[model samples]
Target: MDTDYDVVVAGAGPVGLTLACELRLGGVSVLVVERLAEVDTTIKAGAINTPSAEAFYRRGLLPALAAVQEENLERISGFMAQRQGGRGGPVTMPPRFAGHFAGIPLKGRLLDASDPDFTGAGPAGDIGFIPQEPLERLLGGRAAELGAEVRRGVELTGFEADDEGVTVHAGGSAIRAGWLVGCDGGRSTVRKLGGFAFPGTDPSITGHQAMVEMEGAEALGKGWNRTPTGTYAHGPFPGRILTVEFDGPPADRDAPVTAGELQASLRHVSGTDVTVTAVHTATRFTDNARQAADYRSGRVLLAGDAAHVHSPFGGQGLNLGIGDAMNLGWKLAATVRGWAPEGLLDTYTAERHPIGAWVLEWTRAQVALMRPESHAQALREVVAEFSDTVAGTTFFAKKISGVWQRYDAMAAPGDHPLVGGSAPDLELADGSRLADHLHDGRALLLDLADAPAIRAAAEGYGDRVSVVTAAAPGRPELAGLLVRPDGFTAWAADTPAPTATDALGGALARWFGTRTALPTGPRAA
Candidate 1:
């Protein structure tokens, strides 16, 4: 069957755009259709966690992220000054600002960076403050640069998928594609049309987040505050307010948020008559957590919010979606490019479903702690105390930072500690890092101790894998490593060449398929 593109991606949000870029990098054609003519400027996620940052870093996008972070830090500094009544001069983010759990601050100073999850994580291991709007724009541009076609104002109204290819109806035109992916967000049209079963807990809270001009705002306390009725936070930035009430989900979630409605919510949660005067932007949210029963069905697939969703309490939504894209992109491309092993594409759901489930439960836990009941308040106090200790702070930091995220299925039984985890940015003898070699999106086999057997194992994969011989002086125990396109360590060898060859060969075959007759052209250090 003739297809317009190898993959047709619905929605040009960060997830879709990032996937488009990845598919393009993997040498597959991708078409990204966004319903909106322009990027949405709504206030969404304020930061990207460690794993998300590291993903960007591996793709050599860290310089762009750093630029965005600098701008955000300046804006944050100004907001801090305004919060302090303009007395402080250029207030910077507190050194202890790791992140929060149930609105409880986790101090960075108390966190042990030497923990196994964190050691050798490199510079992108920290949380990066780049809001959703800019992030989408960045990824959108990157997708285009990588040769993915992005069409705006193209709504995916329907699609028909069979054993061969998918015919997608968008913007009153039917386009054919080898595969279709839904990144269209919570109310995903692709997911609905594809008959994907979504199930999860119902919401018990109605939350309001907005930026507006208001009167009597001084009556509300600054930062996160839990009252007898609910929880409210005021002013990290002037006119920025958020309130959560356990009064059931909004009657009309799609209804426009008016200043009067926000005022009432603020009054209810803050127990003060803070009058909202002029509303600039506002939205309603809920703890409506849900996950698709499966991420794929035949040629139709789902990623980002189309696959899972939960409360935005811990700022995990965008990061989680980015992860879905990173995990799905190369695998889908491999399948499209015809080198994927049997059931390689099926591993997407197997590897990512568990992570999505964990995020849902993590958000639900925060919701439980925020409940207006007296018991919840007591539980919050206990959790708060736990967060204050060194171990507790490190634990929460690992979770919030995304350092704790590892794919158990990606590892062999009794694998090295680095297996299933992001490859440490090992600096080679030539002063280059592992990430420096991954910009082209090929799998990498790093030989630290000049192992001919390990190098021979990576041969015949052609350009699918790049073998680099370099000594990583920092990690003397690591003799060799197989790093996947997404920067996960597929295989690690601390033993000698003979002992590691068979395992290396198995990993190469498992991920890159059967070895070909292509010449072994190992790149020099």
Candidate 2:
């Protein structure tokens, strides 16, 4: 079937844009369509986790993220000074805000940065507090620079898929592509029309998160507070407030949130007569957790909130969607380029579905601990106590920071511990890091001990994999490693043994296809 592009991505949010950038790097033609004419200025997702930050670092986008974080920190400092009545010396932020669990603050000073999972991560080890707006803009700009075509004000109204390709109808016009990915968010039209089954628990709480101007704002306490009605948190930034009420979902989820409505919820949760004077921006969310039965169906696929959605409790939504983009982008591009191994595209679902399911459960656990009753409050106290200790703090930090995430499906029999895990950003002899070599979005085979055998094993796939021979003095125990395009370690070698070379060959063939000319057609059925 003739196609206008290799992949047509629906949505111009961070996830879709990231996927487009990855595909462009893989030399695939992609088009991204967004219903809105401009980027949404929503104050969503105040931070990104470690894995998401590392993904950006590998693509050389960390500098952009750092700039955004600096601006956000300045704004936060200003808000703190305002709260302090601008009296004492300039109030500074804590050295690290290691994130929180169910509103329980995990002090960054208590976290052990020397943990094994954090090794070689460098500056990307820490979580970044970049709002959703700037993150989307950054990804959009990168996608554009990579030559991914983006059409704003074009909505995916419907689509039809066949064994050959998919015809996507957007903005009253039909466009053809080899694959269609729905990054269009929770209410994704592609997901519904593609017949993906969404199954999960319903929501029981309506939460309000907003930035506003309020009268008698001082009446509300700072930080997280639990009352008889529900829970409320005030002033990480002045007028930046959040309240959760055990009142099911909103009556009209799409209705615009008003000052009077927010004021009533604040009064009920804060137990104060605080009045909302003006709402600069506001959004309502719920604990409605759900996941698609599969991420792909024939020529159609889903990513980000299109595949799974949970509460914004742990700030995991944006990070999770970014993960989806990184995982799927290369695989789908390989398929479109006809160099993908058998069932390569299918692994997108196999490796990511479990992670999505786990995220759903993680958010549900937080919601369970946040109930307004005495039992949940008692449980919250015990959990908070556990979270304050060294071991407990480390555990929560690992989970919240996303360092513990490993793909069990990517593992082989008797694989090294590093296998199926994120590759450490090993520094080379010339002082360049592993991420520096990965900017081209190709698989990497790093030969730490100058082993000709390891390099020989990667010979056939030179077009798809880059071989780097560098001395990693910090990790002398290793001889070589095979890292996928997404920075996951596919194989690791302790010595330049023949058996290690054989394993490297197997991993290469498994991921990059056979040692022959690149196929010009689809995989043989």
Candidate 3:
């Protein structure tokens, strides 16, 4: 074992790299391990959500991802077919959900940013899907730039934790760290070695993925337009209709996927696959699974796929991982820097665990409807209707596009009028934008309403807080909302309230310290 680094993260996927970068920014000496000799180049996750985009944007890596693939998918819900006991049935789409069914959103998000509550504006906060490998390369470089020690061909064999920290085994040697995070995928050795229990339901069906250059399949529609046996997946990716088919049974991720097996399934699902000019790769996987019982054990933590596994039905697995890293990053950094409370570490599990379950709940319902059928007719009808519901459409759009992530579950206090809401681009007193002011990657309080309460709170704290006052209502969209650094609501107040100063001050003290928890301080001019 070697001397202790501040942190050690296993599995250098995008999530892992992001976590390491966040820790490095907090002055943590980090070591990142990956079993693969090189980064993966597959375009696995084709979509990026807003939270991930925002996180990457903060780190200046979104442009790299956007440069690689800039196809923008706006709406959400789509159809995925599954096979049941070798019985081929009708293609049934998950119900259209009429307008905006909350139930469907609980499934997979449809691809649209049509929600009224959603403000899709503010300096390009949108989701984009790119292949995972290249995405990691870009992020890994950024992580290394932030001082993370990235090591390829190294693997985390195991780890031992005590009251102080953890000693990680990787690269044929032992490495000590103040903390460890497992960002490895579903078949996580870190999860296994830590004796953590994965408590969630199993996937209903397995999926066979093939990056085949099929002859005549054209991605003609917005969603997965099917032809009996195959699905035409036209995404942000150029010149490729991601063609997929459901075959006999779901195989383990550890199991090998073959072009031959996928070719046969294409014939079964599409009814006439004809021939594959080139099978880039065929892989079998399932849509089932959820989170670990705990995200932290002693000094060891888990993020990304390591903490949760799910049917990629809504393209959520990667997004989920990204979200996990984001959720843990700031809190870990805050704790490391002494700004956060002792219980902040526990919030990672409490906050993110529910989100993991939420992903599973969304995917499980969506996967169930994607069952294999003799014909594609039934599936078409389902997509058509799902294309109509608020819940379903919002879910799909939010899931695939990454907007459905409402930060209500974030542990920051929510009683404030605008605490758990999204902050829009507002004009500051100097006419600069509120978002531009947040370039520091920290929590921001914009006194757009010019509420006396907020003015006084800032004065009371002095250098402890950086408060920006907007001259007038900035976007009209976020007129009364108090946004957080994570682009979520912290506490909101009526700007023109007579007792607004006292009310707002009390609200602020609740989350940021004594100031936000108790607002009895005198109002500043």
Query: Highest TM-score: which candidate?
Result: 1
- What order do candidates take by TM-score, descending? 1, 2, 3
lDDT of 3 at 422: 51
Q: How high is each candidate's TM-score?
A: 0.97, 0.97, 0.78
Candidate 2 matches the true fold with a TM-score of 0.97
Measured with C-alpha atoms, the lDDT of residue 388 in candidate 3 is 63
347-457: candidate 2 lDDT, tens digit per residue? 999998888898899899988888978899999999999999877888987887788888888888887788999999988888989998889999888989888898888
- The order by descending lDDT is 2, 1, 3
Clashes of each: 0, 0, 66
* Ten-residue stretch with the least lDDT total in model 2: 516-525
lDDT score of residue 510 within candidate 2: 86
Model 3 lDDT tens row, 1-525: 345687788989989988887776555578889999887754476555566666666545545766665322211211222122224555443322112121123233443445643464344454354566667778888887777888899988888898777888888898877788899888888888988888887654545655665554431443354554445343222223344444433544566656566556655555554455676655566655767999988878889888888766666788789878877876777665555645767877876787788887877665544544643346645765766665555655544555455556543443553455555455555756656655455556666665555665555443234466665444444334445445566666554464545545554554444433434333221
lDDT of each: 0.88, 0.89, 0.61
Worst 10 residues of 3 by lDDT: 74-83
Better of 1 and 3 by TM-score: 1
